[model samples]
Target: MVSAARTATETRTTTRTEARRAPDIVAGVADADKLTDEIAATSVDPRLWTGAFATNVWGGRFAIDGVLGEGAQGTTFQGTDLKTGGRVAVKVFDVGRAKDWKALQLFDREADTLKSVDHPGIPKLLDVIVDQETGARALVRTLVPGESLAAEVKSRGPLSEAALWSVIVDVTDVLGALHGRSSPIVHRDLKPANLIRRPDGKVCLVDFGGVGRMRESAGSTVVGTFGYMAPEQLYGAQTPATDMYAFGATLLTLATAKEPEELPRQGLSIDVEAAAAKLSPQLRALLTKLTAPDPSGRPADAKALLAELHAIADAKDRPAAEPSWPEPMVDSPFAARGTDGDFLVGIVGVVFGVLGVVGAIIVGQLLIPLVLTIIAATADGAQKERILAARARVVEAAKVAQRSFERSAQHGARKLESASERERDRAEHRRRRKRELKRHWKDEERRLKQLAKDAKRSARRDGRFWV
Candidate 1:
């Protein structure tokens, strides 16, 4: 009987123990379900949560949408900034696929340089990502919208003289800023492909992987496009003037719609004279000086080149010297004119007088002189009309050109404004979403606190502790 009583007590104790642990087990399961629901609700792409399992780069903050371009060292991708819903360009350098250490060196240098500079003509650095597992590095920057000059020229024929001049002005302005720095930075690889024209008609210089200082150690690995590289750049002699030579080559490429190397050469140097024969004299002269065989032959710097360009532009803008009017000979009959207008008035008076006299000379030689005067007046009037018409046409043409320029500017401004509005809307949406999430978590926390309070009260009433 004593053994049976002991077994009964043990069974009751075991039942109470399970009753106490039941709430804890249920709470743990509820938390797991809540986590799964949160993930499902918040994730735009659930696959991105898997990190390395996904094909995209940059874990969770950024997602690659498409490839922008690929070079020998790395590839650039168009990506989305998940946090802000903005677009970005991500340049990924895969260590495993790199041909040599030079690739990494260039990559790191590009990252460093981008981080240091601030310019509208240059991309703004957003983030630097290093994947420890893959040993890959990525640089995230604001994507400059537009096609490269190379692609632009390929699809559309060579740019007009006005368009080419616009490009030159924009690029040189950017180069001026870069080269004017305390420690000059040479864009060792300035080529058509590396220059992007933005939608707003501004030029953006990109691909800083090959960028270097003005003076570097000898025997440094040559870094630049073959056709656009300066003669000295081949020997690791990079300088500000080296970039000027590349700039000239790039302009030649755009002007001719052909690669620089494709053009005829003068010994080791490009035949700038032959290649630029079709360009204006001023432009041809500028190209000749820019692509000179020796660095000393080129302009000293961007500033000096700009000054020369301004001078040329000023000369073109000046009106041609008023054509010298031959002095009327002292014996010439036409010298009697007071002015063209006075001459016309006198001729009209003579016509009226001739008509009055014709009645008296009905059979005289005065008839012939009357007809001659009328013919002279008609000829003079016609010549005045022609001159007026020519002036009107010139004025109209100038107005049309001005309107074209204004229209282009307005169109670009509208596009920029539209883009900014969309960005603002996206930012507002993000803020609203963030506020909603905050409110949701607050409500969740309140519910949990109340449940805990109720559990504690129930344990006290039942004369037991809740696990």
Candidate 2:
């Protein structure tokens, strides 16, 4: 009995010690919740941590690896969905406790949005997990395998106008699709960093943590990248025009290697023509109009902006042989809900009429095409590596934009065909009606002539009788 009791005590003590020795693991989170008693640095995404990673939310045992990238809104970690073993990008608002449950709700809402959406460029939504105990929530999505636009800009340097336009068009299509919905979705934030270009040359939008609800009946939060944000967005008004403004700004940034808002304005207001004089003047005018401080001055929604992009594409290139694939931004569909924290980052779509110029990069006294560097290379390794990357991205983005423009044209062609068919039917019906009317008028004229002839004959006969 004594020996058995000693063995039991020893086993119990070993069990407790082992439990204490295990590392703390927080799942469904990528950052330390300031609200929690314990705060930690975000060295790596918690989701990517397979060996042992923990958040305030939950703990899990997993086998995965790789760190994709990080952003202000959320850090994206490369990992696998525990169930299916599929590679995925886990985005979580692990920082700052609850923040009024907005983070969790956004995660839930984005998941619902992802489920309803399907597109190649838009990452596929595999699963949404909410920790029962910790209340931590996350969106499980297919990993976009490529460098971000920011990475491209950073490593490659400023892209060319053509390339910049391509990326803009690609993201614009994604945004256009989202905003094209009946209620419309405004990508509150649109920056090169938020965009990713795949090896296949496809561009996609990532990070929906800042996404807010834009009801036809209500308002939305003003959230987006600083340099790329529209004036209205910066002022707290969310609208599709605001996004256009940001798009223009992004283009300008790539062109000039300067922020849109920082451009030397003609006095207080920006002279779109002057701000982007380095680009095609027409492009400069369009961008200026888009970045107009007043919401009234811009295109009403993403589709119209798409139309303008098509126009640009048309003037620049010819049509493609086949239809292009669709790239959805902020994928998923769900019912709209509330909270001051229920942030639909952009406004619901609206009807609009309109468009930005690429900025010119100034390289000190000697204006060399370089500045944004990727991976920071040793001096003289390859002179102007950053410049090369920028040039490459610009070329690729232009091709992409050109392709998206062609795709839109394809849609337009279908619409045009429908309209032309209707017109032809109307014209044929009008022609038949005209023929019937003409035939009836001729018959009446012939009858009237015969009557006149008879009257004259009777008059002659009467005259002869009188004589």
**Which one is best on lDDT?**
1
Clashing pairs in 1: none
TM-score of each: 0.57, 0.54
Residue 88's lDDT in candidate 1:
89
Off by over 4 Å in 2: 1-62, 69-74, 81-86, 215-222, 234-236, 267-269, 313-467
Task: Supply every candidate's count of residue pairs whose N, Cα or C atoms clash at under 3 angstroms.
Answer: 0, 27
lDDT of 2 at 361: 16
Query: What do the candidate models score in CA lDDT, each in turn?
Result: 0.69, 0.56
For 52-134, candidate 2 gives per-residue lDDT tens digits of: 23432222423224345566545555665555455677765453454555556666666766655444567756555555433
lDDT of 2: 0.56
Candidate 2 residue 230 C-alpha distance from true site, Å = 2.4
Q: How accurate is candidate 1 locally (lDDT)?
A: 0.69
Q: How close is candidate 1 to the true structure, as a TM-score?
A: 0.57
> What is the C-alpha lDDT profile of model 1 across 419-452, one tens digit per residue?
4454444345445656876996799689768866
What C-alpha root-mean-square deviation, in Å, does candidate 2 show against the real structure? 35.8
